[model samples]
Target chain A: MEVFIYGLARGSTLALMAVGFSFAYGVSRLPNFAHGAFYILAGFATWVFAQSLGLNYVLSIAISLVLLAAIGAAMYRFILIRVRGMEVSEIIASYALGVAILEALRCKFVGTGFSTPVFIEGTIKVAGVPIDLQRVVIIAGGVVVIGLIWAFTHYTRLGLSLRGIAQDERAALMLGIDSDRAATIALAIGSALAALAAVIILPVGSITVNEGYDVLISALAVCIIGGLGSWTGTILAAFILGFAGTLTATYIGTMWESVVVVAAIILVLLLKPSGLFGRQKEFEERV
Target chain B: MDILEVKDLMVFYENAIAINNVSIKCETGKVTGIFGSNSAGKSTLMYAISGIMMDMKRKEEMKGGERITVVGEMRLNGEDIMDIKPNDRARKGVVLCPERRRIFPESSVLENLKIGGYLASRSQAQETLKYVFTLFPALKDMKGKEGGFLSGGEQQMLAIGRALMAQPKLLLLDEPLLGLSPAMETRLAQAIKKINEQIGITILVAEQYARPILPVIDYGYVLENGGKVLEGTAQELIDNPDVKEAYFGV
Candidate 1:
């Protein structure tokens, strides 16, 4: 019961971290390597607002989220826009920006001593396992986020256009959907999501620069194993990795967690090169 | 009155000319056709008119790949619109139903139509959706089906329906008949005529097969090796020996 409960919470956390990355990639085919940097930045930004400025916790989170979203949009408009179609350049450019921001934060005092306050205080017993209220919030928040995204993509015009652009960019363009505008909006939303996840999940642990790299790796692992750009696949891969990590920690050793995540990615790549749900282009019907 | 007029339009991919000194005019509320074989600049002409060539040019430049050059005067309703972006042009009522029916594969039929109606008002979208379902009743039954799973005829219908959802004044259909059976081609040709007659939307259709399309077009142009070789009314084209030999397969 304890293992299952903890694994579910971890899986939800992974989902939250990866959803934004997957969404941005799906729309623009742009892999935002800065996603982890943005996540950590949100945590620190909130801490500064709430701790230093002495603002309300909720207000600090809202302001930081908006700030992160604007930063993301600016990142795409100013930097990523020039290198949009070149895959190698996109990766290099985004990763460089991410490293620059994270390293700058390191210089400023975002370390192990900094942490955000949790939304709620206390613990609850569920299925004979004691789980923190924050963990429950994370799990519920993940589901709500996923549901909202699903509805947005299905019912809203802007969301529909994003899906259209993701499927066939030129086709969407022909219909008058501006590709650059959609991509910019995608980046903004993606960044805001990363921030939301950070604010919700950071309360459980202290902030550190090292966590930036770890979050990126875990998000990448989930995205790769589930197939990049697939929302359903991301959630499924998260649970798979989450349970595997929990089992390894319980049975083998806690140090094997990272090893298991990496191994899962390697094994998935070896078995299915296009991830699990990726619609292989070569197999697509060409008439 | 001419809805669209292109004069001395020249398009080049690096040094190779894809369309050279081509001039064409589409009259308001009429179906104009351009017939050409593969690599004959039919798609290029459509892209140039729809302003998508500019987008391709930008993408190519960004990748440091081929340099695309487009030079010409394109007038829509007597106003020069060569500098407008594709989406802006779409807002100005020019929409392209692209080649191979580039419908969103993962989205359902209804969702694809809704996406195409991005620039439309809420009421316009709703009314257009109803019109599309009425025009292609077959789509109404398959509203939930994924676009990738549709048949060639159905996909082509959906493509036209999707373009109609954009509420274009001048619709550019790039090879709408590609990969369809003879019966489907004839049916689509008739539907194109009905759209023009009923909705009064000006249409420019590009195709390699001229047999089914020739009967529906008011005026047609023949392109060969990236240059216009002939232009005449549909009757004149059918009577011309060269057209009957090359295009009619007579």
Candidate 2:
């Protein structure tokens, strides 16, 4: 029960962290290295709004989400747009911006003191396993986010336009979707997702500059394992990694947990190069 | 009046000319066909008119390789659109059903149509979806199939149907019958005629083979080596011995 319940919590946390990065990359083919920056920045911004300004907690989160989305759109329009197709440059540019933001935050706040209040303050027993209410919320939030994303992509015009661009830019453009516009919208939504993940997950452990990097790594790991663009593959990967981590800690020492992740990635790469559900066509094209 | 007019158009990839000093006029509510063999610049002309040349130019600049230069005056509905983005051109009612049927491969047939309707209002989209279904009923049956899974003829139908969902004033078809059976070509040719007649949407189609389309086109141009060599009414082209020998295999 402990392994199952705790693993579920861990998996949800990962899903929240990674979905935004996967979404932006999948849609625009833009790997947002600043995704982690947005996550940490949201935590800090929400903290400033909620604690320093004495604003309502929910309102603070809402404001931060909007701000992060705008920042994301601006990032694409002003900076990343220029380096759109050049993959290597995109990574370097975004990663540099991410470092700048995170390092700036570290310089200013330098905190072990930054954290947010949980929305609900309690504990619940799931299958005879005691879990905090925030962890439970993260799990529920993960399910809800995935559901909303599925519906959005499947049913909505704007969402479908983004997916269309992801599949074929020329075809999408021929259909009257502004490829850049679709990319901008994708970046905005991705940033907001990062912010959402941060607000919900950061309360458990204090937000720090390093957590930003850690979040990005976790997101990257999950996305890679899940097969970069496969929606089902991401969730399944999250659970797989989640259970893998839990089992590692339970059987071997907690020290082996990190090794398991890297090893699994290497193993998957060696075996299925495109990740489990990854479309192999992209690889074939490159070859 | 001409819905689209290209004057003194020239395109270059560093030095080799793709299109040279080609001028063409497409009348409102008429099908104008441009026929050419491979690399004779039929696709390039379509790309130039649709503003995809500008798109490729930008992409090349970003890549810092293979500079593409397009110097041309393209007037759509009497407004100069020589340097506008492809999507903006699409919004302004010149939508291209690109060569090789570049439909979204991973997307379902229905989703492909829906994406094409991105610019349409909800009611317009609904009406156009019905129209597209009626025009290509084969598409209606395989609404849930991925576009890549469709046969070549079915894929061409989906591509045309998808473009129709955009509700363009001037539709551009670039080699719409590139890889299809003769029967399929004739069927698609009839459908193209119906689209022009029933909806009154102006069409500018580029083709390699003129037979399947000759019956449907009002005016046609023959292109060779990226330059316009001859053009006239379909009957006049049929009467010309050179065109008959070269194109009709007489």
Candidate 3:
């Protein structure tokens, strides 16, 4: 039961990260592999601000979110838009973003160990399980993040435009979407979400420059398992992955955990190519 | 006074003149039709006026990349709108319901309409929605449906509804009846008339089939091979022997 709570906490973070990635792909139609850079870089940034700079945890998180949002917007305007007309095989743009961020981080702080200030420095007992308060906070933050994202996509004008772009960008443009503007907005939000996840997860685990690749893989798995372009699917997949990982680690063995996940995902894919909750050409076909 | 005026406008595609020295005026609260054969620059002129086509003639001269040479002037409400951006033009009350009925395929019908009302205030957008729903009640029934699933005719109605949501002073419609059945075409035609007569929306339509459009337009221009072959009132073009021989196939 305690293990399940731990897994849920971790899965919430993964779900938030997946939502960010899904938004960009949903609206921009570009699978930005570089989004992992946001996770890794924000982790590094939070560590630096919290440990080296002696900034408070709250301040570091705020600065990280704002900085990442700005970086996302700049990357979209200066780079992504330029490579937009290029073929999808041009994953080079994302690679370029990753290289730039990694290089910049390395230059600023070389050979620094990863550490982040605790989000909450206490423990709580729930359902006969003792849980870290920070983990609970992380989980709560994930819930808030997902809720806000859902609302943003459903309720706001810019959100509607983003949804419109996700549907068909050229059509949105003819309807006057200002697509470049929409892209910038989406990138900013996506980056902010990634940064938030990074900060939330940092205190729970040590973050390293290379750890970004791992998070990237996890986010991709979550996104694919949930299905692309669907927010609700991403969240559900996150919890499923979380509990599954927990159950596997607790019952089976640690060695075969990742293997089990891979096999499970394959089985799910075979059964439903669009993911568990994804609609495969069935959403708008009725009309 | 003319709401939209295109004078000596020439659109080209790699040295081929799609629209050459074509000049026309769209009066307020009037329906004008540009009639032509398939390759006769009807869609080209509409594309030019809507700022969709690139003026390939002036590519090297301008600061922007691949300058589209627009030789003459396009004006709206006596203001030169040739230099303004397409979105800016739309905000300025000159909207186009393009030929393909470019509805955002994944968006709900209501969302599509709201996007068309991009320039309007929140309340104004709702009002526009009410107006469009009133004009095309079929769309109101499918408000939550994605546009891609709509039938060709329903999508055309949505396209026109979207343009009207912009509350344009001048609506430029390119082939609204394309691919639609005769009954659907008549339905759209009636909506176009209602927009003109009831709401007094000034409209310019470019169509290959003149029979459905001819009776409704106050004035018409006939284009052949990228140039205007004839221009007159709807009745004059209907009665003319040249028009009868070429267009009506009498």
Best by DockQ: 1
Instruction: List lDDT for all candidates, in order.
Output: 0.92, 0.91, 0.80
Q: Could you give candidate 3's per-residue lDDT for residues A71-91 as a string of tens digits?
A: 988888887776664535336
Q: How far in Å is the alpha carbon of B124 misplaced in model 3?
A: 1.6
Per-candidate Cα RMSD to the true structure, in Å, reads 1.1, 1.8, 4.0
How far is B6's C-alpha from truth in model 2 (Å)?
Answer: 0.7
Estimate, for each residue in B67-173, the C-alpha lDDT of model 2 and write its tens digit: 89888788987999987899999999999999988878888999999999999999999999999999988889999998878888998999999999998999999
Off by over 4 Å in 3: A1-7, A88-90, A107-112, A224-227, A236-240, A260-287, B15-17, B54-72, B245-250
Off by over 4 Å in 1: none
Q: What lDDT would candidate 2 get against the real structure? A: 0.91
Q: Considering TM-score, where higher is better, how would the candidates rank from best to worst?
A: 1, 2, 3
Pick the lDDT winner: 1
**Which candidate number maximizes TM-score?**
1
lDDT of 3 at B82: 81
True contacts kept of 1: 0.83
| Candidate 2 regions with alpha-carbon error over 4 angstroms | A280-287
Cα lDDT tens digits for candidate 2, A166-211 = 8888888888889888889999999999999999999988988898
Q: List the residue pairs that clash in candidate 1.
A: none
Candidate 3 recovers a fraction of native contacts equal to 0.21
TM-score of chain B of 3: 0.93
